[model samples]
Structure formats: C-alpha cells, structure tokens
Target: MVKLRLKRYGRKKLPSYRIIVIDSRNKRDGKAIEELGFYNPITNETRIDIPRVLQRLTEGAQATRTVQNILDRAQLIAKEEN
Candidate 1:
C-alpha cells in the first residue's frame, strides 16, 4: 500500500518535514515515490502541491493523522483562494 507521511530532515535542533508518498513496507525515511509538500513545525509553515496531492489522494494513497490534518487545512485554504 502507498502511504502519505512526513519525512524528517534538517539540523539537530531544528526539524523540518517533507510530505511524501512511499510504499508502506519501507522504512520511514528510506525513500519516497513523490514529495508533495513541506512543513516546518518550528515556524508553523507549510508548502504544498495541491494538484498533485489531490491527484494522489484520489488515486488511493492514505495519509497519516497529522498529514490528514495538514491536507484538510490546505484544502480549506485552497478553497478559500478560489
């Protein structure tokens, strides 16, 4: 199964995450099929590729709880923009 989740990166004290699509059997940070967005928890910032994200979501990829919340918020923001 393909899953959408966060992959950690950045320096020791500061952490940032990439929202990625990968196979469920793989290790958390092993590799990714696609990177749909990024999130910086410390700064509370997000950058997402909505079209690609929606495409993957429609194609059956599952999101982790945090990712789901982020996606939902991004969708709401997108809707407001259009």
Candidate 2:
C-alpha cells in the first residue's frame, strides 16, 4: 500500500514537512517515493504540485487528514475536472 504522508524535517522548534508518497510500511521521515509538496506551519505556507498530486491520488494514494485539508484549501482538484 502507498500513502501520501508528511515527512518531518528542519531545525528543532521550527519544523517543516514535505507531503510525500511512499510505502505505507516505511518509517516516517525515511525514504520518500515522491515529494508532492511542502508545508511550513510556522509560516502558514504550503506548495504542492497539483498535477502530480492528482496523478498520485488516482493511482490510489491516500492522504493524511492534514494533507487532505491542505489540498482542499488549495483546490488541488478543481470540481470541473472531477
């Protein structure tokens, strides 16, 4: 199973995360099959590759709740395309 989850990184007290696609069994922060976006909580900033995200989703990737919210906010999948 493949899942889209966050990979934590950055300095202590100033964490950043990458929204990535990887094997479900892999440890968090370990190897990522593909990185679809980045989130910086401290800055309230996020960026994602929409096409890639959609592609991965279609390929059966499951996003974490936080990632889902982020994608929803981004309008990553425009309704017209669905």
Candidate 3:
C-alpha cells in the first residue's frame, strides 16, 4: 500500500517535513515515490502540488491524519455531491 506521509528533515529543534508518497512497508525516510510538498513548522510555511496530490489520491493513496488536515486547510479536495 502507498501512503502519503511526512518525512522529517532539517536540523535538530528546527524540523521541517516533506510530504511524500511511499510504500507502507519501507523504512521512514528511506525513499519516496514522489515528493508532493513541503512544510516548515518553525516558519509556518507550506507548499503543495495540488494536481499531483489529486492524481495520487485518485490512485488510492491514503494521507496521514496531519496531511489530511493540511489538505483540508488548503481546500484541495472537492466537495462530495449530495
């Protein structure tokens, strides 16, 4: 299974994360299929590739809880039809 999750990086006490698509069984930070965005908590900065994210999601990629929240904040997901 493929998952959309955060990969930690940067110096100690100043962490940042790369939103990545990777195999569920792989080690954390081992490798990623694709990097979709970046998040810097210290600086409160975020960058995302919306089209790529949508494509991945459509292909059955599941996001972590934090990533899901980020996507919700960005309003990237379309509303479901009633």
Candidate 4:
C-alpha cells in the first residue's frame, strides 16, 4: 500500500515536514515516491502541490490524519454531494 504522509526533517525543536508519497512499510524517513508539499509547524506555513496530491489520492494513496485535516482546512478536497 502507498501512503501520503509526512516525513520529518530539520533540527531538533524546530521540525519541518515534507508531505510525501511512499510505501507503507518504509521507514519514516526512507525513500519517497514523490514530495508533494512542505509544512513548517513553527511558522504555521504550508506549501502544497494540489494537482499532484489529487492525483496521488486518486491513485489510492491514503493520507495521514494530520494531512487530511490540513487538506480539509485548505479546502482542497471536494465534498461529496450525496
């Protein structure tokens, strides 16, 4: 399975994250299929590749809960109209 998730980086106490697509079994900082965005919690800043993210999502990559919340807050996903 593939997962769209965060890869932690940066110095201690000042972490940054790269939103990446990777194999579910890979190590947290292992190789990634692609890097879709970046998040800096300290700055509350985010940069996303919307098209790539949507493509990965359509291709069955599951987003982590935090990523899901970010997507929701960014209004990146279309709501179901059932």
What are the per-model C-alpha RMSD values against the true structure? 1.2, 3.3, 4.2, 4.1
Model 3 lDDT at residue 81: 32
lDDT of 4 at 21: 95
Model 2 spans > 4 angstroms off: 76-82
Show where candidate 3 strays beyond 4 Å: 76-82
TM-score of each model, paired residue for residue = 0.91, 0.89, 0.88, 0.89
Candidate 4: the clashing residue pairs are: none
Candidate 4 Cα errors over 4 Å, as ranges: 76-82
Tens-digit lDDT string for candidate 1 (1-82): 9999999999998999999999989998988999999999998899999899889989999999999999888889879999
lDDT of 4 by residue, 1-82 (tens): 9998999999999999999999999999999999999989999888889899999999889998999987776664345532
Which consecutive 10 residues in model 1 have the weakest lDDT in total?
A: 70-79
- Candidate with maximal TM-score: 1
For model 2, residues 2-81, the per-residue Cα lDDT tens digits are 99999999999999999999999999988999998999999988889999999999999998898899889778545657
Between the candidate structures 2 and 4, which one is better when assessed by lDDT?
Answer: 2
Task: Tell me the deviation in Å of residue 17 in model 1.
Answer: 0.1
Clashing residue pairs for model 2: none
Better of 1 and 2 by lDDT: 1
The collision pairs in model 3 are: none
Q: Candidate 1 vs candidate 3: which has greater lDDT?
A: 1
